[model samples]
Target: MKLIIAGATGFVAQELIRQSLRHPDIKSVVALARRPVAAPPGAGADGSKLKSVVVKDYDDYPEEVRRELAGADACIWTVAITPSKSKRLPFEEVTRVCQTSTLAALEALHEAGVGRPFRFLYMSGTAAERDQSKTPSWMPEYSLLRGETENRVLAFAAAHSTPSASAPPDFSACVAKAGLITHSYASSLFALGLRLAMGVPSVRLEEVAAAMLQQVTTAHGFEKEPLQNEDLVRIGRRALGEGRA
Candidate 1:
């Protein structure tokens, strides 16, 4: 299957691209980034199956860029301004990158003529609120906005779903709401203790990528809409084990 890894420069996006290249069922990988992405070390071995497509802006897609994205079976969207990282940027910029870019990419993909049953996996954080009406005391604005974005994406999927059995589903979207990502090397004892004290769940980076690929590659797409942290951890572990064997 042809997979598109959007926001290719991010930590998670890079991992997704790396895993997709090694995946046996993945026929091609398109790395979509604002800037050019250098081929990862081992990715060159599958040189023929991997390619990069650079766009001037995430909110704008030129005709040529759309043409390059045509026929893609799935897209893993990792582009978003995390709450922790949004402190330094203006709220407008964060909203544009986190919310506007998402819808723009989806519209571009549709206009590009991506075939039926196209899968879109959005990378959202576990703390993101699902209800926009009630805001949490902590980071209320950011959380609400993220929730609204998720709702928009889910609504888009519903709008595109096939009305009858005779027609194929136009689009299938899944939101993977990950928690604090744990790194084998960077996660120290202090960090682990802090997370535990705060009651925040965490998952390894590898697991996140594995779980996402498994969702799209399966014969049937994800059974649920927003996959929680525990679900990802479980699926990711299984996917990693299968890949090793």
Candidate 2:
């Protein structure tokens, strides 16, 4: 399968790319990023199995870049900063970059003749929900905006399908709502404490990527809720073993 990994240089995106290279079912990977990715050590300068599509900015991708998306079976969109880091840029900018750019890219795909059955897996946060209106005051705006984006993307996915001509427009989308904890020192420590004290859940990065990929490749109905970490672990393990995601 031909896959596209958006935000290829991101910590999570990098892991997904590395893993995708090892999957026998994956034929080629298109790594879309603002800057070119350095080939993995031992891989050629051209990145042999990977194609890096560099854009000046996520908000403005050129037509040629859009064309590169043709024939892609799936897209793993892993862009967007955490709420805490979003403050580094204006909230309006963050919202546009995170939400608007996503819409633009999908539209680009359609205009570039990408068939509709294409699966889009968005990396969403756990608290991104229609009912999450009362998150901490400090980040209410960001939370609500993300929630809105999630709703919009889900709606769009439900209306489209791949190889547009062969199937009615019925694109599929899944949101991998990762946990507060990640496979990092700080996050791991916090997850350990939370598990022992507050029963908070955490997941491995590999598991999260695995589950997200499965959601896209399979024909399961659209998922309406944020997938919890434990759910991801289960689905991920199943997916890694070539079972239904």
Candidate 3:
């Protein structure tokens, strides 16, 4: 299946691209980012299956960008600003980066003519609060923003996924609420202290990517709207054991 990896230059996005290149089921990978992306070494020999598409503005999809997205069966969106990054930027910029861009991409991808049951998996954080009425103790503003985005995204796809006079919506969306995706250093004292201080759960990077890959590639599409951190860890561990990338 053709897969699109948005925010291709990110740490998580890069790993996802590396895994996608080696995945037997993924026929082609479209890497979308502000700058050109290069596949990881020793993967995707000659990098023939990977194509890098640069987009200057996520708010607007240019003709070339839209053309590149055509026929894609699924997309893994990893384009949100992290909590730490949000602090350094203005709230307006953060919202545009973390929320507005996502909505735009959803609309653009839907228009890309991806056939029935097209999967769009968003990489969200556990801290994101879906209920706007309640204030989140951690990063309340940011969490609410992300939560709002999640609800909007689900609503957009829900409208299409539900049956209508024309047909069932061709689009579907899933939010993977991962928490503190880390590397080997997760066991380190600093990392441990950080996790304890923030009260955030942690999972390995591989696990997050593996579970996402599985959900998007499954023949029947994802089973639910939100897949929590534990679910991802479980699915990822199994996939890694089976050498499934």
Q: In TM-score terms, which candidate is top?
A: 1
TM-score of each model, paired residue for residue: 0.94, 0.83, 0.93
TM-score of 1: 0.94
Candidate 2 at residue 126, lDDT? 68
How high is the CA lDDT of each candidate model? Answer: 0.85, 0.74, 0.86
**Among all candidates shown, the one with the greatest lDDT:** 3
What candidate 2 gets wrong by more than 4 Å, as runs, is 39-47, 132-138, 161-169, 195-200, 219-226, 240-245
Question: On a 0 to 100 scale, what is the lDDT of residue 27 in model 2?
Answer: 73
- For residues 1-245, what per-residue lDDT tens digits would candidate 2 score against the true structure? 78899989987788777777666567788999998985544333234679899988776868789888888888889888788888888988888877998887777766666544677778877656555545644367787777788887777766554445555345677677777647678888888897898665778777787777666655553344457677787887877677331
Across 145-244, the per-residue lDDT of candidate 1 in tens digits comes to 8888898988887887777686446688889999888766567454478577986778888898899999988877785779999899899999999872
Q: Specify the poorest-scoring 10-residue window by lDDT in model 1.
A: 38-47
Better of 1 and 3 by TM-score: 1
lDDT of 2: 0.74
Which pairs clash inside model 3?
160-169
| 83-103 per-residue lDDT for model 3 (tens digits) | 998999999999999889999
